[model samples]
Target: MEKSRGMLPRLFFFVSRPVRGTRGPARSTHVGAAGAFMSGGAGKRTAGPGRQGSRSALASVRAGAARVELERDDEMNCETRDSGVVAAGRAMTVLLDPGTGGAEANYPTRPITLVLGAAPGSGADILARALLPDIAAEVGQRLAIDYQPGASGNIGAARVARARPDGHTVLLSTRSASLHKVMYPYMDYDFARDLKPIAMVATMPIVVVMGNHVAANDMLDAMELARFNPGRYVCASVGVGTTNHVLCEILQASAGMRMQHIPYQSSAAALNDVVAGLVDFLFTPLSAALPHIKSRRVCAVAVTSQLRIDEIPDVPTIEEIGFSEAGADDWYALMAPTGTAPRIVARLNRALNAVLANRDVRQRLARLGYMAPG
Candidate 1:
């Protein structure tokens, strides 16, 4: 039940039975089966004594659905949209009940491909590696990670968007992908139209790190230098439209400075350049920059969060340095191709939530500077 805490209230599944006089493959309107099984917010259903209990549960579900519909219009930000429940569940009608001999009971007929938009050492990749072992155990199959890092995660996103929707291929998306619409107007694939939201898994803050050779000691000093000598300094990002790039833009805007923006295919490569002093600085996840910061290869100028993190307690937050506008947290979510079956999505959601519930898994994420949702 704890594993299903934040998931079941929004995810709905239906068991279809033939009505007495209905024609075609139309399902019964009873709603009892779904309510009875999903009660108590548990992933599995328990048998109820009568239909009365089911009816009451159905009413609650409908009410929740209506509230979600209303909230959908209010979700104007990228992070809010990523965590939306009912709006993402417009396709819930296709959710088949596993109790009725549906294919969801025996899902993952083959190995699943988890497509990541960044390289192996990136935040998305780190979270995936931390959780995949437990998720694979729950789902009864291996989840092969396919890294296609490039174009600020667009290349990997496009591959998953076009992949077959049988649930065998899913994208491990980040908040960065959601901004692609504004960043690249003419992108080949539509993120909202082409991808299905499964669940928002975790979130973490970005760190502003600089190479050892940089003349400045902190973010304010670096900004002053860049402000005085325009375009003399350089910053790097995974790609132009990524969260890294967006944060870079925010820092420059907030400080009223200019620095050349260099884009890379992966965070590891970008951080490497920063370490080698080929680039002056970059905005990266703490997990990616923590090692370098520890080794003193790169100095953590500031964190993009309201408060400082324990791992880097000495580093001040951007807000602490008077750049409140630049403070933001990065998040990760699971998504499949648009047409992926709802039943399959439900199965994956259950598996994912179960993995997130483990205390060890939560601790591992904490060490990586990520917080898993309850």
Candidate 2:
């Protein structure tokens, strides 16, 4: 005699029956049964096959319960937590499919809102626009990007933090995610505390440019400009607490270099002063400094990255010049307020990665100084 695999479903169904002197009809069917199944009456049972069916029935019930418990939280994936088998029916894959909630096919029910902390003309805002188009297409809903600039994005971040947990709203910001705790220690909500990590965005490198006349003849020469000159050297930055400010502080603390930290109202003002040698040094991103470097207005002394930057291969890195740790830069990434459904996160990750794969989107982002990808 041979056993039929078709009988497995029957066996699984029979296993759910109780064997304690239980009796019931064999055929049972229910419509729209996702986890719970239709079964015959529970009555008298025998000690042989009836007992086995009853045990299998109990196993099925436990399986469904375990599946729900494993993926309903902030953990990475189903495999990490629930010892639950990796299958569509049992596992939770958020951000991978918009119509994941028991739909016949993954489809989004509403538009998604991506909130950014930068101003309208800022680099972050531009990057958001560049990335949003393709992603919005994939998810089948128009993406509405809302920029909330005050408090460096605290206002908009707070909005998402309090939004519904159904994954409609997202937060996009730079490395400031981690520093937000430090930047606004007294704020009502903390970044990492209130938001969940989605995916890391591209990293923008900062360049170390210098004036022609101030070329450090030697290490002693550079140190002289840093230490001996002291307050005579004024450092200009687009604003306080940006990568520029961090780099300026690192240099001051590491080499005993002292300079006046002047916060500019805008990047243009700081660039102009640096070009005219009105400011001793200015810390800016490659995108902002590229124009000055090409126009012979500013010199790129070194790139902040640990290696030589491809855009400006002629420039050296800070580490190469015996400065072991005086480099600082910014990296951007996607985040959602805590408690957003994991399924939604997985869906968004898939959509965003698909958009990034497009050749035109990739090239345009590179042109924007994101270095291809981070």
Give the best candidate by lDDT: 1
Off-target runs (Cα >4 Å) in candidate 1 are: 1-103
lDDT per residue for candidate 2 within 1-374, as digits (tens), equals 01111100101111111112111122211111112211223223223223344345344554653121112222222112111112213322222333443222444678888887655545566667877778789888888888776554567777777777666788776543344444555878765457765654555667766655566743335546656554555666545555555555544444555556665544556677777777656776666677777787877777666567666777876656555345544556677777766566666665666676677877777776663331
User: Estimated TM-score per prediction?
Assistant: 0.73, 0.64
Worst lDDT window (10 residues) for model 2?
A: 4-13
Residue-level lDDT for 2 in candidate 1: 15
Q: Rate the local accuracy (lDDT) of all candidates.
A: 0.65, 0.54
lDDT value, residue 355 of candidate 1: 81
Across residues 184-240, which tens digit of lDDT does each residue of candidate 1 receive?
568888876788877667777789898888888787788778766655677777665
